[model samples]
Target: MEKEATRKKYNISVEATLEVIGGKWKCVILCHLTHGRKRTSDLKRLMPSITQKMLTQQLRELEEDGVVNRIVYNQVPPRVEYELSEYGLSLESILNALCNWGETHIIKKYGDKYAVLEDSILNQ
Candidate 1:
């Protein structure tokens, strides 16, 4: 019974974490937030296609999940910054591996140069 309870707890934690960073945009957002704290405007600039509403929704979800922290600075205009929590940073290696794999597998297949070119000035 104790072992079963332990397994259930593990499953819940794993599933919840995956749910937080599971989506395409979520992972990218998390990766960008890892760089530093950023405002909604900054994130929009980094990912031009992401709409304001979607960005807000995603940020809200991440904050709710305890994967992100929102710092609101007191001012005439609210200066809110979003940053990753320690739990979020734990996925950095996993995200980086995905990046490397995408470069080699996805990008390489249909990159500008269809044929693999040797490193030479002529190839430039």
Candidate 2:
């Protein structure tokens, strides 16, 4: 007979959501993906502060969580790209809300949203 897997419980509902998307880099990575598909190099360029090892680890974790899809293409050099899975697209509104709140906070403190934020494609 096959055994059934156990279901984990969370103290707060948000905690369960955080468990999958929580982290310093996960949201940033997902934000980039929301724009379009990106390879490891593209992501590194977008997020210059993240180390190669850390980026790999975070991507792997996201892939494992079923939020990110890894697409490997067979070519001369072998190319790989990452994109948000269907389920992951559901977080778009949440991410947008966080971004709006952050802009508000920055403007409130610095008197300008762009003052503290870097000029990137996502800034638009």
Candidate with the greatest TM-score versus the true structure: 2
> Clashes in candidate 1: how many?
0
Per-residue lDDT of 110 in model 2: 97
Name the candidate that leads on lDDT.
2
Tens digit per residue, CA lDDT, model 1, 53-93: 99999999999988889999999788999998887788889
Clashing pairs in 1: none
lDDT of 1: 0.77
lDDT, candidate 2, 47-78, per-residue tens: 98999999999999999989999999989799
How close is every model to the real structure, measured as TM-score? 0.74, 0.90
Model 1: lDDT of residue 15? 82
In angstroms, the error of model 1 at 78 is: 0.7
Cα error, residue 118 of model 1, in Å, equals 24
